[model samples]
Target: MDAKTCLEKLKLIGVLSFATVDTQGNPQIRNISAIHYEPDGMYFFTARGKNFCRELLENEKVQIACFEACPAKVIVRQPPISTRT
Candidate 1:
């Protein structure tokens, strides 16, 4: 899907799946709700001490996906980015 449509789908979905890796390198996916969709960048919240946090610290690469009832999907593959709000 296109960028605008993807963003709209994300907002409609509200919650999304964030995938990370355990120490052994297995895939771990979790449901997340604290997210903000910005024109310049997207924002999401998770505790710093959580496993998902550590996974990002250990491996910068992360995968994010959000799907809607219309069968629309948005997949993002990139390194982790941290910014103070």
Candidate 2:
């Protein structure tokens, strides 16, 4: 699906899964609702310090899996901005 369609589908559910690989190549999957989608890409909030945050900083390769009638996976890269400001 296109980014717009994919984003709309993801937003409809209001929740998504974020997966990352640690330095040792261990797969890390976690349920997340903090992801926001845009026409260009996705946006979200995270602290400057956190395992997930650190992981992303080290490796931008990540996945956004949203709960749907069927499973959907969206590969995400780059660090998400902190909305705390």
Candidate 3:
């Protein structure tokens, strides 16, 4: 699927797993529900003092996975990108 289509699917899916790395280089995964899609890029929200928020601040590298069990199935791999929110 195209980038726009993939982003649309992400919105439709709503909640998805977001993975990040900590200072120790250990992988951490969390569920993120607040996601916004724009023409330029995708954005998500987290509280200021949250661990996940700190993780993002220290390491911008992250991954998102969307799983849909329906008529159609898709898995998109998004590269690591910096985010500020």
Candidate 4:
């Protein structure tokens, strides 16, 4: 599928699973519904004080997963750029 199509499908799914590693190197996962998609990539929101935000700040790498129940398909992606400064 094309990028546009994939993005559309993700939007239809509404919520996506985001996985990240904490400072202790443990895996953390959360469901994120607030996202903004652009041609280049997508942006998701989490409170600055939240562990999810802290994990993202500490570790740039993240895995996003989307599941389509009807088709039984799973899409996983990792951002090419760092999310932290």
Model 1 spans with C-alpha error above 4 angstroms: 1-5, 83-85
**Distance (Å) between predicted and true CA of 78, model 2?**
8.5
- Runs with alpha carbons beyond 4 Å of true place in candidate 4: 1-5, 72-74, 80-85
How far is 43's C-alpha from truth in model 2 (Å)? 0.8
**Models sorted by lDDT, best on top:** 3, 1, 4, 2
How many clashing residue pairs appear in each of the predictions shown?
A: 0, 0, 0, 0
Q: In order, what lDDT does every prediction score?
A: 0.77, 0.71, 0.77, 0.75
RMSD of each: 2.3, 3.6, 2.4, 2.4
Q: After superposition, how far is residue 2 of candidate 2 from its true place, in Å?
A: 1.3
Q: Candidate 3: lDDT over CA atoms?
A: 0.77
List the candidate 3 regions with Cα displacement exceeding 4 Å: 71-82
Clashing pairs in 3: none
Q: Give the Cα RMSD of candidate 4.
A: 2.4
Relative to the unseen true structure, what is the Cα RMSD of model 1? 2.3
- Whichever of 2 and 3 has more TM-score, that candidate is 3
Model 1 lDDT, full chain set: 0.77
Clashing pairs in model 4, backbone N/Cα/C closer than 3 A: none
- What value does the lDDT take at residue 21 in candidate 3? 89
